[model samples]
Target: MNGYRFDKLKLLVADDNQHMRKLISTIMKAFGTTSVYEAESGEAAWQSLKKIGIDIVIVDWQMAGMTGLDFVRKIRNAPDSPNPFLPVIMLTGYTHIDHVRLARDAGANEFLAKPVTVKALMAKITSVIENPRPFVRTKTYFGPCRRRRNDMSYKGPERRAAPDAIDVDGIRPVGSGKTGSHGP
Candidate 1:
C-alpha cells in the first residue's frame, strides 16, 4: 500500500518559449513523473487545462497571449476549477521583491528564480509536498528552516515533544522530557 502511494504524478509546463517548455517537461519526466503536458503560451495552457487533468503546474513569469500570472488567475477562476487546490510554481529570471509578491497574490505556491537548477527544483517540489503552505523563513540550530503553516508559532519551544514527530528539518529528537504533557 505504501509503495503505491508514491506513484507517478501528472504535471503541466506552461511557457511561451518552446525551449523552456521542453526543458521543464524533460526535467519532470526525469524526476519519475508519469506524464507532462506542455503549452507555448498562457492561452494555449488554458486550452490544455480544458482538455486534460494535471496534478501541478510549472509556469514561466513572462509569456505572450497571456502572462503566467493571468493563467493562474484563470485556473483559480474556472467554473469547475481545473485544479482548485493545485500547486503552482512560478519561474522567473527576475528577482524583484515585487515580482515575488505578485506571484504570491496571483496564487503561486512556490517561486523559482530563473536559471533554476535541477536540485533546486526538486527541493522546492519536495518541500511543497511535505508542507503545502506558504514558506516562512526561520532560523534554528540546524540551519535556515522553513515554517509551513502560519499558526506554527512555538511559544519559546518549551513544550514536551512527541516521540515520532520529527522537526521541520526532518531531524529526530535525540532526547526529550516527556509526552502528552502541558507547560505554563
Candidate 2:
C-alpha cells in the first residue's frame, strides 16, 4: 500500500450494483485515488471511457446493458476506442479458471474475485501499474499478451523458432512462398 501511489491514477468502477460500485470507489479513495468515477452499466461505462481520460477500469462481470466481458472486448477491439491500451481489471465473483480465461481472452489486464478487500484491490492495482503487458495483435486477438512467462530454458516440442528457421519437429515453414519438399 505504501509502495504504490494511486494519487495520480484516474479509475473507473463499472458495476450494475450501486453498493458494489460504492464499495470499490471507497477503496479507491483510500488508495489516494481522487478521480474515481462510477458507472451503473457497461454502456454508461463505455460512454464514460470515451469522455474521461481514465487510466484504469475496474468492471464487474455481470452488468445490465453490457457484460464485463463485452465491455472488455469492445475496449480492446472497438475500431474507434478512445484507448485500446487502457488497463482493465475484472472484479467479479466468478473465480473459476474458465471465467478467468474468458476475462483474459476478452482483454482484461487482470482479474479480481468478489468479496473484495483493500489489500487485494491495492495489490491488483499495483500489479497493473508496475507490470503492464504488451499488446498483441493477432488475427483473432487484439489485447495484452496472454502468456505470463517466456521461459527460454525450456526445451519443448512447441518451442517457437525463427520464421525462417526449421523447428525441432522437422516442420519447416514455407519461406518467400517457395514450395519445397520437407526432405533434408
Candidate 2 lDDT, tens digit per residue, 20-88? Answer: 999999888987889999999999999999999999999999987799999999999899899999999
For each of the candidates, the C-alpha root-mean-square deviation to the true structure, in angstroms, is 11.0, 10.1
Cα deviation in Å at residue 47, candidate 2? 0.9
Candidate 2 off by > 4 Å:
1-3, 150-184
Cα lDDT tens digits, model 1, 1-184, are 1232224677788888888887777777777776788888888887787788777788998997799888776666557667656788888886754465466556677778778688878876776676676332222111112222334565465333354332322323344544212211
TM-score of every candidate relative to the true structure: 0.69, 0.80
- The 10-residue segment with the lowest total lDDT in model 2: 175-184
Q: Which is the leading candidate under TM-score?
A: 2
Best by lDDT: 2
Compute the lDDT of residue 137 as modeled in candidate 1: 27
